[model samples]
Structure formats: C-alpha cells, structure tokens
Target chain A: MIEAKNVNFYYGNFHALKNISMQMEANTVTAFIGPSGCGKSTFLRILNRMNDLIDDTHLAGECLIDGQNIYDKSVQVDELRKKVGMVFQKPNPFPKSIFENVAYGLRVNSMGDKSFIAGRVEESLRGAALWEEVKDKLKKSAFELSGGQQQRLCIARALAISPSILLMDEPASALDPISTSKIEELMYALKQKYTIVIVTHNMQQAARVSDKTGFFMLGELVEYCDTKKMFLNPDKAQTQNYITGKFG
Target chain B: MKHTERELQSLKEEVSQMWKLVLSQLEKAKQSYFSGDIELAREIASREKRVDAFELKIDSDCENYIALFSPVAVDLRLVLSLMKISSTLERIGDFSEGIARHVIEEDCNRMPPQMLEDLQLDRMFDMLTGMLSDSFVALESENTKLAGRILAKDKEIDAMYCNSIALIDRFLSENPSFIHCGLKTLLLIRKLERIGDHCGNIVEEIVFYVDAKVLKHGAKQNKE
Candidate 1:
C-alpha cells in the first residue's frame, strides 16, 4: 500500500502541491486525471524520490510505502527506485537490443548469473506482453520496433527489476489508438502483480483502465472514487464539470 | 470564474423554454383534434419550427462549450445529457406536428365524441406531460429518487398505450364506419407513447446528474 498524509511539495517559493492526502492499495490501478500542471506527475515522482534530482525542491509530508517512510534519511534512494519502477510518457528505450533493455536493471544491480539474467529477461518480456512480437528479434536494437513495441519494451525493462509498484505518467499518450489499447490491456494484466499509479489527460482512458480515479486540480485532490462513479456520476460539482467536458 | 456554471445555467434555461413550447404544442394539438379547428392545428404545425430552432441552438452551444473549455466530470455529463435530451425533445415536437396534421386531414365533426372519451388518450397525454414536467424538475433539482420514480412511472404510460390499442379495436368492431377514425386515433396513441419514451430519456439524464451512474446499460460491475 502507498499512503500520502497531508502532503505539500514546494519548488523554491512556489507551492506546487497542496495539503493532499490519499491512500492507494496494493495490486490495483489508480489513475490521476486533470488538466496539465495539476501536480499529478510531481506526486507520482515523489513516491520513489524521483524529484530529488530537481533543484530547490522541498517536501513536508509523510509518504509511506509498505508502512515505511520512503523519505527517511536512512533509506537508500537507489534501492527505493529499484523497488518502485517508473515509465514515462514517451517510450524511452535504451540504445541496445530488446534483451539488453530488459536486462539493463539486473546488470546495473549486478543481480543473478548470466543464465539467470537471460531467464529473467524472457519472463519480463512475456509479462509485458511483448515476448511473441520481439522474441525472434531479441538481439535487435529496441529502436527497430514500432512505438507501441518500444513502449512494451520499456514496461519490460521496468518489470525486469521486479518492482512491487509501477508509476506511469501518460504511458500511452504518445502512442496510436491501437498501441494505447495494448498498453491499457498490459496495465490491466500488470495490476495483478504490481500496484500501478498512472497520470493521464484522457478521460475515457482513465474510465476504461483504472480501478480508482483521482481528479486533481491546481495541485489539490478534488475527489477520489471508483472509476465508474467518477466517470458516469461524480459527487462534486467541479468533478462532474471536468469529466463531462463542461470546463477544465 | 468557472465558465461551466454559467453554461450549465444557460443550458437549463434553454431546455426549460423548449419544454414550455412543446407542452403548448401538445395542448394546441388536443384542442384542434377535439374541436375540428384546422386553423389551430396549422398554427401548432408552424410553431414546430421554433422547437427545431431551439434544438439547433442548444446543440451548437454544447459543441462550443466542449470545444472551448475542455470540461470534465459533472459538467461534461450535463452537456452530453443535454445534447441527447434536446434531440429527443425535438423528435417529440415532430410527433406533435404529426398529430396536428392528422387532425387537419380527418373530418372530426362527424366522429363520435365517445370514441376519444373511451380511448382515455387524454389521460395518456396527461401522464406524458406530467412525466416530462417531473423529469425537468428532477434535472433542475438533481433529485435521484424522483428520477427513479419517474422511470418507474414509465410503465404506467406503457400500460395506457396497450389499453388504447384494445379500445381502438373495440371501437372498430362496434361501429365499422368508425374504422378510419380508429386508425387515426391509433396513430396518435403511438405518437403519445413515443413522447413517453422521450420523457423517459430525460429522466435518464436526471438520474445521471443525481447519481453519477449511467444506468443506460443497467448496473455496471463494481471495480472496487
């Protein structure tokens, strides 16, 4: 489980995230939806200290994963990241073969023998639903695959490390409809093993793929509820207005 | 500074005015049919243009709001439901005109008064009117329970429609000379039934507003 309690984030003097609080369960897909710059991406990155690389960023909230404070000084950022893998909006596959892309995490961590790495690579590729398409081309560079295939490869790389949580920021926004649907299907399948948090601008995508949906605006979590209720009928007037395309 | 509030209020007013015009047309159609007043029937038929215009204006407004604002959540549902409800209302207006045309064609003076009285079509019209009225009220008030009750009341209208068909058959058997009138009354009864359907559609919109559930395809499987 992931929990944020009265979380507030700041970039220099600008308050980027408000006193937001939410709990995301294990092995479920939770979607964050809003217009651009609503701080959904910021919140997602905070889970694994991805924002630590940014300059002048300050946080004053408890973000706990599996009942442990991820922001504690004693915690190792590198290990935290390995346990909580992330995929970005664009498919940023490494400049290497498909097999190497999946094997990159294990290589960096110096985990397992050569045969074990090979076995794990095939398993991650299969888990990402990209094994059949790229099985014969495992030795080929990731750039040789189409945008959709590359995205699946990226997901495979994320899963290669055996992360318990996956954070995706518009994982399918850069792909075509068919590819987007493929990613959605993958997310559905992945949720059985990995707790997933996604940020998206597409309302229909959120409605279709997510178990729970959180609507954010101006860095505040306006409402969080079941996806069906959020899309078909939202409780707050603001939430309803946003989903119905009445106004941003 | 939320533009959605203003647009939603405007949409409500537009639908309200359209409802008023539709109800007026329905009333005028009944008068012309019973009294053999061709002039009033023609007037009602001409007024259909206004309903059509309202539908067009509302459609354009909804499109503009969607294009300009990129609304989400309840505002989006309201716009979508309004677009559907407006089209349904326009179709209802067309049915009203159809009834007006039938009144103008048939020589109502020679028809038996007992024919209209026995069909209880006026009661059906009353129910249809009440249904539309309640649906509009539910929309404005965001009343889910009232909307659910309106949905249930649709069955009453459906039963009345079935009873009308039986009444027409009975009337035809008693006086074969009135077969033509019976057929025309049957067509009018069908139009009223369609109006009930539109009212039901409006009720559906209201339920969407109050509960945030589509209920369009029945209860969805809970993801939670």
Candidate 2:
C-alpha cells in the first residue's frame, strides 16, 4: 500500500539515496538487505516523515500511501505516524507498568476511557503475542520482563493504536536466537493484518520471512525479486555475491 | 584478503584432476577385461586408494570453504553440489574396483564364450563411457540442455541392462556349468548400470548449476 517513485534523498548534498523507487504491496512482508549505510533505514523512515525530524535533510520524491502523497503539505504528519507505526532496532519501551506501556498510545491520542483502554491494552498485547506471559502481571513494570518479552511488549504498544502498516528497523537484532525466531514467526503472523517493511543484514532471515527481497548495495536497488529466486539464484552478480557472503 | 577466487580455482583444478584419474581407471579396467590381462585388473584394483584420497581431499576443501567463507548464490550451489557429486564419483570408483576384483578372481580366460561374445554388453559399456564423457563436458560448460540430454540417455543404458539380463538367463539355461561365470558377468553388468546412475547424478549436478533446480528423484517423470 506504499509506493515510492524516483525518490532522491539527501543529507545536505551528500546523496544518501539516489532515485530509488519501489512499490510495497498491501499485507506482505518486504525485506531490504544490504551492507550498513546503504540508506535502507533512511528510505524506511521517510515513509512516515520520520526523516522530517532531522535538520538539513532534503527529499525529492513522491511517497504515497493509499494513492495520496504523504509528503503533501495538506497531509497531517501526526495522522500519518498514527497510521504507520514503527519499532526501533533495540526495544525502547517506556519505563512504566506493563498495563500503562500498552495504554500509553491510547492515552496520548486522547483515547481516555478507563474500561475501554484496559480492553485495548489486553487486545494489543494479545495481538503482539505477549499477552499470555504478561497478562497476570499487567501492573509490573516493563523493565521486569526479559529482552524478548520487552520487545514484544514494545510491539504491543505500537499495535495499541491499530496501525495498518508497521515499519521495523532490525527489530530482532538485539535479541537471542529463540527470540529472533519468535519475532520472525510473529512477523509472518502479523502480515495477515499489517503490511511490514523490515530492513535486515541477515540474508537467511530475509529469505525466511519475506515474500519479496530487495538487494541493495551502495545506495542502489541492485535487484528485487521473489525471495526464493533471490536467495537461490539472484539475477545480479552483486546481489548474488552479497547474499552468498562472497563480499559485503 | 578474500581467497574465494583462489579457492574456487583450486577446487576446479582438484575436481578436474580427480575426474581424469577416475576416467583412466575405468579405461584400464575396460582394457584389462577385454585383453584378458589379470595384472591390469589387479593394478586397477590397487589404484582405488587414489580415488578415495581425492574424494576425501575435495570433501575437506568444500567443508573448509563453507565454514570460512559462507558462500552464497552460485558459489554456494557449486560447493554443495560438488560435495555430493564427489561422493558419487568415489562410489563409481568403488564399483569399478569391484568389477576388477571379480575379473581377477574368475580368471579372465575362463569366462564363457557366449558371455564374452555378447555384443549387447559391449554396447552398454560404450554407452556408459559416452554418458560419463558427456556429463564431464556438461559440468565443465554448465550446459543444462546437454545435461538433460545426457540424463535422457540413462534410460537407454537401463534398456541395455535389461537386455544383458535376458542374455545371461539364456546362456545359463543352455549351459548350467557356466553358472559362476554367468553370475560374474551379470555382476559386471550391474556395476556398469551403477556407473550409468553415477553419470546421471553428475548430470543432475550440472542441471543444478545451470538452472538452480535439484532434479534427482523422479526428474524425468516430472519433466513429462
């Protein structure tokens, strides 16, 4: 449901992304893979104007979500963010009670009905696959949970608002293998309800989770194709070399 | 420094040399079987160690590359397929040595006249040689079409194998005294049939390289 057309982005004349264009289909996981500093995260943040927070950053492109350019002055940034939720590389949960952590989004958006908010908190936690573990301890602080639990709690917090799109930047990188796999499984499950765009350095994870894979190198989209073909037999040598661990 | 290029070149050379050695052993065995030379058969049997050593070396090299480089794409496929194809080649070598051992024990001169003059057995050997040679070429060139063609030839070899079985049965009924020689000849045909299988495996590897598809079991059926 997101489309970027001939997108050129710059950090004060140091062209970070060059004429990058891609269409993200609704309710499918699309993974962006490349070496570090290839502008994958930059392109991801621009979807919801997260880049607008950075000074001296200029963008020239049409980033459309559901046929309307989000960069248009008429579009509201707050509304765009509410529609497009994000989770960071590390789990950044507010230091609050587990109940309040899920309630924070509804609270800020003035969704302030005591019993209604409680229902949403549980539902969001359930949606994020964190409800069973933390249901009895809703009043316990978020810090009491393990890294994986905390990350899932953070996901619950993001899902509290009922966003249609979820943008994840290396969501499982800081977690252990079991946690990583859980997150991968959660992503696969989440795709039926939300469109996901994940940027990963792990090629195998990208192959495992995504329906389509975009191989990026030095801020260029070298190849984009079905995940199986991309991993088994990529069309470009650069894509092949990068995925095979032959080169960075 | 990335030594992938160097490692790939080294692997290519090693596999090529191993192919040459195996082919020479097969040729020696065939010549010994034809020329009634028991010493040549014994020599082929003794040289089996070299084939075993080559297989071990290639296996270790592939494992080292995988552990160190974590190769992807075509490189990954090549290494993986090479590991499998190497073992198949080694097995084919063992079969060749088995045939040589049988010839040595049976005393080549005592082999029956009808079994020795059987033209179908000669045709099967010639087809086996052709399949091996074509597979080697297909692997070197990464020619998927040629590989498929070579794979199709395997059925012809199978038909020859069936023909040889019928010939053996006919000879056994006509002369019961030649049972030992008949069984040995039948076993030799079985060895050749196994060689055709190995050649089919090599063709499969070539197809994997060219098309990135694993077509080993029921490959022909699937194509149909």
Candidate with the greatest lDDT versus the true structure: 1
Q: Write the per-residue lDDT of candidate 1 for residues B1-224, one digit (tens) a residue.
A: 45557777887799889988988888787778767788999999999999999999999999998897665556677788889888988998998899899978865434476767777767877777777777777777777666656666676778888988887797779889877767777888889888887777777776665566676645322210
Candidate that would win on DockQ: 2
Residue A121, model 2: lDDT of: 93
lDDT of 1 at B212: 61
RMSD of 1: 6.0
| Clashing residue pairs, backbone N/CA/C < 3 A, model 2 | A244-B72
Instruction: For candidate 1, write residues A140-163 as lDDT tens digits.
Output: 999999999999999999999999
Prediction 1 TM-score vs. true: 0.72
Interface RMSD in Å per candidate, to 1 decimal?
3.9, 1.9
Badly placed stretches (over 4 Å) of model 2 are A132-146, B1-18, B46-71, B107-130, B140-183, B214-224
* Model 2 residue B96 CA deviation in Å: 0.7
Off by over 4 Å in 1: A244-248, B1-21, B38-72, B79-204, B210-224
TM-score of each: 0.72, 0.84
- TM-score of chain B in each prediction: 0.90, 0.93
